[model samples]
Every structure is written in C-alpha cells, then in structure tokens.
Target: MAQWIRGWGQRGWAAPAGVCLCLFLLLTACGQSAPTGEKCLNCHEGIEEISAAHPMESFACVTCHGGNPQATEAEAAHAGMRGGRNPSDLAVLDAACNCHNGLAETGQDHIHRVRTSLQTTYAGAIAQVAFAFGAQPDPTARYGMLAVTDDNITTATGQPALELFRPGPDDSPMLHRFADNCLFCHVGGEPLAQPYFYRSTGCAACHMVYDNDGLYKGGDPTIDPAEPGHAREHRFTTAIPFTQCNHCHNRGNYSLAQMEFLPRPDLPDDRPLTDLERRELEYYQPIAQFTLCEWKLDCIDCHTNGEVMGDGDIHSSKLEVQYNQCQTCHGTPDALPLLTTIDSVDHPAIRSANLNPNYEVRVGDTVIATTRGETFGWVLWDGQRLWLTKKVDGMVYEVPLALGTACQQKPDEQASQYCHECHAYQRTVAPLP
Candidate 1:
C-alpha cells in the first residue's frame, strides 16, 4: 500500500497532494481498503462499478486478476497478471477460481463448464471437419482445440477425455486447414481486431460487451477511446444483448475446401443503416426462419447457463448438451410446461436472477426449468399465462404455451427446426432508404 502511494504519479495521477490526502482519509473513514481505494483509482478515477454485484469499491483489481498492486511501475505491476490483461482466458482462468471455478452442481462452476463447453473446445466443428476429410474415423469428437478431461462423466454422450487436436504429416490438408482457419472462432483465443468481430477471450468474450468498432466508450480516463479490440466498458453482465453474441456466431461463413473464414460483406458505412436492415444482417443469414421470440429476446433468454456452459462434462457435439428446446419453455398439447418454484436460496437459479436484474426470482414463484433442471430469471407463470421478461430490455411478452392452442407438436420433435414449420419469421429488407 505504501509503495502504491509512492508510485501513484508513475501511472499519471497528477492531482495535488492535499486532495490525495483528503481522498485517502475519506476512504479510510468509509471502510475501504487503502490500496483499492486510492492506487488504481488514481488513474481510473471515473470508472464505475464493474457490476452492481461486484462493486468497484469492494474488489481490488488484483483480487480476480493477479498483479502486484503495490508495485511502482507498469511493468512491475503487471509482471504476474493472469492471461496478460483478460483473466477469463482459459489458459490462465485458474487465477480467478476463487469465485467461479468448481466441479459440483454449484452455480460457481461456470468457468469450469465453459472451459469444457463446445464453444471453447469447438469439438463438434473439429470432429466434423476431420471426418469429412477422412482424417477421423467418425464424426464423434476425438479431439478439440484444447485438451480437456472430465473425471466425472455423468452423461452417456460425455467423453472421458479429449486430446489437443494435432494433425500429423499424413493427415488430410482439410484437417490442417481447419487447424489454421477455424480455431480462432473458439473462446480460447482472442477474436479478430476488426469491426463486427471485436471481443475478449474466454468468459469475458460474452460477459463483457464490445461495440461493433471495439472502442472503450466508458469514462475511464486511462483507457484509450481510439483503441479497437477492447470491451466498451470494464463491466461484466449476464444480461448479454444479441449484439454481443453476434460478434462470433452470426458474423460469417466458412469454406471447408479452401479452409478459410469468409466474412459476410459489411453493411455500407457510407449511409446510416436502418434497424430492420441491421437486424437482418446481425441476427440471421439471408433466409432464416426465426420466430418472433427469437428476434425479440436476447440470446441469454432462451439459452440458459446450463445450455450455454457445459455440465462439467466433455461431449462430442453441442447437440448432446444443447437441450434448450422450443417445448422446454412452452409445453405441448398433452400438458402445461413443467414448473418448479425456487425452493432454496442456494438453488443455482437464484444466481441467475441475481446476475440479471430483469426480474425477481423468489420462493413459491412458478417458473420453467430445463429438462436438465437449470432455470433462468423471468419467464414465470401467473396462472393465466406464462410471461417472458426480455433480458436486454425489460419488455414482457406473453409466453404462448401450446396447452390449448392448435398445435400438433410431438414430444419427440420439439427442437427449433420443428417449430419453424409454422412459426418461422421471414423478414423483408426495405432497400436502405
């Protein structure tokens, strides 16, 4: 703490000594740690809470991201930091394990789950590409970008382990092409440093949002606004907008033969784009049959924590873990949706509500849960109808349950592809006016 006070000016803390002394006394009286209250704040004075749950006043920068907060210079201060700057990077995620890393059914296992999820490993993509090129015997995953092991294999599809995918001299050229081109799409690596492709590594890639241009738009005077490839702010959120997901998922296509990523043509920056036009490009391919709910709600609304993050298991394909079906929330003609009340404070669903401020998750409130027992905030029942509270904006929509509606949805065929038979959206783009 003493060394931090001495080194404050090195990071551009050019305030008067009297003001600094007064600030120190105020922080001490208010019961904040001297180092967190003054040192990093000296340069990042106007920075707001990373999130309401993780107030900047409570957490020191070094708590999640290991660094010498007491050091007198940038090089020395950042000497032992995790993942360079982004602690969420899977390569060095253990640094922030105190809060997020776990192997149990506990909500804290997010980091652990994501580390093994198909998103990080790109297991399905790799396995398919290898199989297509005759590099692998079958489409079932034998390798992934990162070598992962699940000691507790609870599911039938779960693999005991996966080796780091390394193609040999005898391997197909397509395998080498996959290794070169498609690997960057996974969360294990930072994304492209271009517009519409800006994001961080690992968990931060989703939780922390980056603008299409990837500039820091927050009030931190120390950060550079002109800098691209940075999250818009130092905030983490569960209420991730669709745009954040679009950074990776909806951006473009890949050519297996050429082993290359073919970015979709950029919307002309020459003119101000329309919302309809932007939504068309941002969410859908040229002719997608998405439902109204799919367009309205943020990606996180339908895709719960369990569906997005793995269940501490390694799997060959996302289809094994991606169990968020259209009928999961909306029940079939045979019955209403299966509902569970928040029975325990320690229930993982509570954390879902706490992280997102869209709705209150309380005991005795009838809410929907996935077939795998994972629940999210909002989308609750009021006897008359089920309500879906949008995550990005607090827009409430009447969840159309198929209990009495004219629907012939079979129990076995509830995947999204089945829903599009009747509920598909066809968006017509009015030529940019």
Candidate 2:
C-alpha cells in the first residue's frame, strides 16, 4: 500500500495533524462503493480550507458538514443545499471570552463590582417603607408644582398644568424603581462624556477601586491584587458590563445620560425645589445621592487625601474634608493659606506635630504683646494637633507642639473634618506681621 502524508503548514485543512490517519480509517472502514458522506476520505479531501481555518473545530465533519450520509454523489447529499444541523445560538460566533461557561467576568477599564442586593419581593417592601414614613404630600400639592415642561407635553394654553402629583412616600412607580436599587446612577448622572466615555455618574466616579493608590500603593514589586497573595481583593458597590464606556456616551441621541438627582449635604441645590421636581431629580443624583451635573467635579476631585485613624492608624478615612470650594467666598483658617489655583495646585503637606512640654500662653482681661512684638490671645489648643494664637501684628500663627506634650482627641461632630475644624472663621486679626 502506498503511503500518503501532508505537512502541518498546508492551508485549507482546519484539522489536526492526524488528518491522514482519519482518512485511512475512513477508506478502510467504507469500501470504494461507500456513499460520499460515509466515505469521509473521498468528499472531505479538498475541503481542506475549512479545516485549515478552524483546525480545532473543523475536525468534527459530521457535526456540520455531513447530511444524507448514505448518498454517494456530492451533489445529492454533501451539497450543503440540503439542510444539516446549524450552529446553536450558544455556539454561534460570539467572542470566546464572552461565552466562557456562564462566568461573569469583567475586563480591565470596566467596573464590575456588585453594589446593592435588592429583595426579589420589591413591591411589598417599597409600599411598606412609604406607608411607614406617613410623610406623603397631597396629590393636589404635587400636581400644583408640576410645570408644562415636566410632562414633556405642550398645552394649547401655554403649558397647561397637569394633575399628576399625589401624597404618599415614594408611592410613584418611578420612586419605587429607584428605592429598589441604584440603577439610575450609571444610566444617567455622570454618563460617559466626549473624548473619554467613562461615566461621571457611575461607580467609577467615586468608588474606583482599580487604580494604583485605590487598590495598590507605593512601589512594592511583589504586589499583584489580581492574584491571590498580593492584597485584599477590592470590593465595590457595582460594576458595569461590556467594559466599553463609548457604547453609551458616544451613541448619538443618547441624551438620557443620567438622572438629575435631588440635593444632599455636599450638594445643597436640590432644596427649595418643588416636591414634583425632587422626585424627578433623584434619578439624576450623583454618587453620594447628591447633584454635581453642571459642576464637572467628582468625589475624588475634592477627597484626594486619605487618613489612617481608629487604633494603629489602620482604618481608612478622609485625611481632609475641606470644602475649599466654598472658601473662595468664605475664609480658610489663617494658618492655612487658600489654594489660588484650583486645578494645578499640589495638596498641602501636613505632618503630625509633637506637642510636648505642655506649654501655655495666656491673655488676661487685657491682651499683652511679646518681646518680639507678637500679640497674644486665648492660647487656642487644637487638641494636641497644633497651638494657635493671634499675633499683635494681627496675623494668626501656628506653633509646633513638643513631643508627648499633647494627646489626640476625637474631633467634635461639627469639627470632625480637617476643613471644618479650621475654616469656620470666628475672629479677625488686628493686622498682619
């Protein structure tokens, strides 16, 4: 018997290198008079292109390439004009990784953390929450607040008002959808904008736990959060699928970028809004359930510093929470100068000053001036953080404390934040030094 062999590099046969063995077996098992489909050796010979293209998948001939197996003529059976089992939707041309056995995996540059777990029994829970509050407004009050624009319907009489609003906590279908979970955040709020499609309203806006400092810190070569040993896996509130920001942002007619939300602590604009507008606004609120739509700044823009508090400096907290944005109009602590440039300024460096030797400077009924011509006052102690006083020259001054001279104390509720503790101006200095 003459031997037949083909090299691996041959183009058109999407099959394994052992194709010849399959052909030999086919020829031996089916005699020369066997049907073309049955004699896979005869009909599958030249169709090497299919096999070559899908070397792995092309090997299973009967699965797709076989029909009317006993028919001898290629035209009679193998002509694919006759039907065969077509590819299933599950097996059809989807990206390999997308169909990876039902596992929900996200690619780099995408947020995939699950943020909330809503109960399947949503309707009942929502009704209960609304009824418990018993703070529902009257239906007339709600409709009275509606503007022609709210309904998107134009009236013959210059935007006729509609009777839409009703009393009851989150009784509307819209509010119910919102309370069930936070779907509105990514859908609108800070949707991906031009150039970069990263949503300004999505989890990426605030809880972006994928960055260097976010999930990793300082250069430590052995670090690899993706792997098991590197660090704790970063958990987030929610994750977006498809990993493409452009899909939502760049699409034309994508005006429904995010829901405009009601005002909250950080954002104080939503108040004074009519009850009707407040309901519509919740869908567009920022991550903190606040509004930052036109402002163009996210949570990270202001909260760039991190603090270590809670026994051993291990727990994470904001190092500073100054709303310096307000200080442009208000005043900052005299010790801390205002950052003139909002964008390019480097954050001021702060070090824990040692407060030892427990010293005190007193100002009696009448203030006194020091030999250096510095004026003295109540000798404000910043709770072991710093010693502050006003100089006669009319300038506020800060003095470093001696080591072990002071102890750290928890800031009061109102002064818990570095910015709050320092910026609320109570006194004006006489003159600058």
Candidate 3:
C-alpha cells in the first residue's frame, strides 16, 4: 500500500523490514496463520468434530486434500496425497467436490446421484443378465431408460443398443457373470467387512463412519489396512444411523426379507465358548415379514435425503428410490395433510422439529420428524381418525386404520401395510421350551 512500501524500499528492503514483510504476507494470505508451518491442526486437533461442515478455519487441510500443507513431516505431509484417504473416491470425486460447483447441483448433487445410482449401475443386475443371455429382449434393461451418446447405445424405443454391457473381454457371458458375481456393492465398490461393516466409495458410502473404539472417530487417516485398530472417521453425517443403513441394508439374497445369515460355526474347535455360545452365533435368519418401521425407524427415518439421495431422478429401482410409503408417515384414514405450513417455521422439517426437547410446536399439527430427532404428532380425529404421539416415547398410538376386524385378516387399505401385517418382530426368538 504506498506502492507496496515504495516497491519494497526500492528493492533494498528496510522500510521497517518491508512493513513487517507486508504484514506477514497479509496475515498469511488472510487465513491468519499456517502459511506452511505445516498445520493439519498439528496432528489433527481432536479432528474438529470431523469436518464440522468443512472448517479448518475455512477449509484448510490443504484445501479438500492435496498434500504438503507445508510439509511438517508425516512422510512429507502425506506427499501429494490427492484422494488417498478416500475423498469419496469416484477417482477423487471430481477433485474432491471442487467445493460444490461440480457434484452437479440438482437438489444438491449427492455425488452426482451416487454416481448415477441404480445401486451404482447394476441396472437391475445388468438387465437381468441381459435377459438371461439372449442379450436383452426384456428384463426391462434400464440404465435409467438409456440414451448414451458416444459408442451409441439408445433405447427409449429407438431400440438396437447394448453398448457391450460391462465387464470386458468383449463382455457377455452373462455380463462376465454379472461382473464376476454381482459387482461388489457400488460407489467405487470393494470395502465391506465387519467393524460394523466398513463402507467407502463415492460419498463415503453414506456419509462416513469408521472406528476402533475412539468412538466416532472422525478425520479418518485410514489405519484399518485390515484393522490396525480401525480409524477412519472424519465424521460426515446426515444423522444416517440405522447402523449406517445396516451396512448395505442387512446383506445377501437381496436382504431385509429374502433374509439370510449363517455364522454359527467356530465354537467347536475347543468348546470354550459361552456368552450364550457367543450370543447364539450370529443369525439374521428370516424370510419375510419386516416392518414395524423396520423396528421403529432410521433408514433416514423414512428415507428422505430427497428419497435416498437423488431428487434429480435417474431411478430404475430400489422401487424407484422409494418415496416414502404407508401414507408417508401414517396419515390415511382421511384428512391429515399438513406437513408444515404454519408459516413453514423455518422448515428443515420444521427447524428439526423446533429443536426437539421432546417437540411441541403445535399449530394445527401434522408432525413426524424421527431419524433420531424424534417428533411424531399426527393427531386428527373425526375428519376420520388417526392418532399418534411419540415425542420421544410419550407414546400415544392408535393408528390401526380399520381392516376387516376379527384380527384383521385382509381388508388392507395400506395403514402402514396393515400395521406390518400383524406387527413384525424377530431378531431372535424360539426359547419358550
């Protein structure tokens, strides 16, 4: 200022040491400090609550991760580490979400709709293995109703298109047996094992969670190269919990009802087992019946991140990305439609149920919140009955909405699938002897 201290005092430097080196390089380029004193918060200062919405005093761990924040040494500050610690790696999520301008922004681009999800392009298991190998006549082959441009695959009735359906070597042998046995659960695939089934692929396979008892370990530095006491938790969240959507909705044979689990074997080698034989050795064992809001809600408590991340619609199933059912939170006997309109009250579901200290915000009520925020009201009576309460177990309940009585055998007008077809339950039962 003053012509940059008179051109640094005519290049000789000494107008009070070039105005204290131009006020310490303008306060280290306005980020106040750490010009290269190598600060990944000096060994991750309690991981600032895991990217608490991106703030290392304004996104500093080398700006969405590129190494050498001036290299104070973890191998030269992780030497050029671009997306090594999974910056939601779809080959590094367009350069680690180039700060929101490139995840694609329609209803805020959940990693480009989980990178074009149909459970990450299994596209109905590659259109039912290309219609059982006749290379597609029907299994309704849908890459969300295809229209590829280069290498030209086309079909919304302009037919004749297949684009050598995936898994190379000139594809098809049932798409290389559905990409060598049904391509590992998408995103970027591979990475699912216990330790509450670790996940990581684009968007940290549902907003990250990795630990080894540092409980909720955020700022993941990835030490679980096979459990070096598992670390990874820079806590990105959406209040996701349903045990992180049961690590892929409770696995196998299209799980959560086609249900299958085996585990019970290892104890015989020495017979030392007993904590009720290792808690009756792991068994999910079920074949059907599963709703009581899947044991009282938390699949994002009725799936809304614009119905499981994609309001920019490219859905081809998970039942077209499930837009809530059972009358979207139990409302149909007749008149209950007020999902917030009393001045919308700063609606993020009514300001998270008005900061729920056991919610109360009444104004001709119609609440439902939950995903662990828990709100519930629903009231209405005589416009034709409906009743619930549950602001954290204040439990009022009585929403059975009439089925032909006599233990409701079949009239079903979808009142939460007729109260889950006589209320579902089974985690383990059968000891009445």
- What TM-score, computed on C-alpha atoms, does each candidate reach? 0.87, 0.19, 0.28
Off by over 4 Å in 3: 1-38, 41-52, 57-207, 211-235, 239-288, 292-298, 303-328, 332-338, 342-418, 422-433
lDDT of 1 by residue, 1-433 (tens): 0011122122221223433454454344434452443355566678757775554555577766777877757787778888887887787776654455644754456776887888888899888988998987899888988888888788888888888899999998778877878788888766887998899988888889888999999988978899887788989887788999888888778986698999866433445667656665467666467887787667888887766777778888888988777887788878888788878765666556655665556667778877787775577787777877776655666787788877988878877899889888776553233
The runs of at least 3 residues in candidate 2 whose Cα sits more than 4 Å from the true structure, single-residue gaps closed, are 1-114, 117-183, 186-421, 424-433
Q: Candidate 3's residue-wise lDDT over 1-433, tens digit each?
A: 0011111112121122333454454344434443345566666666544443453554556655678886566888878777686666766766656433232322234555555555555465666656666665877645422232212122122222223245546555555555555456565666545444467666767777544122444454433334432335666654445545445555444322222233222212334555433223222334545554444434554455545554333444455555455555554445243343233433344333332233233445555443233233323233444444333322334455432333533334554556566666554433222
The best candidate in terms of TM-score: 1
Candidate 2, residue 132: Cα displacement in angstroms equals 7.0
Candidate 2, 1-433: lDDT as tens digits: 1112222122111333343454444344332222333544454443322222123222334433345556667566555421222221112212211111221221111111111101111112223334444434321111211111222222121222323223445455444444433222322133322222332222223322222112333233334434321111222221212112222321232111231233232211424765334323322223212222111222222221221000111110111112223222112333221212112111111000001111122212122222222222212333333222211111222333323323232223222243334332221111112
lDDT of 2 at 327: 23
Number of clashing pairs per prediction, in order: 0, 39, 5
What is residue 146's positional error in candidate 1, in angstroms?
1.3
Ranking by lDDT: 1, 3, 2
Off by over 4 Å in 1: 1-38, 266-270, 273-277, 408-412, 430-433
lDDT of 2 at 97: 12
lDDT of 1: 0.74
Better of 1 and 3 by TM-score: 1
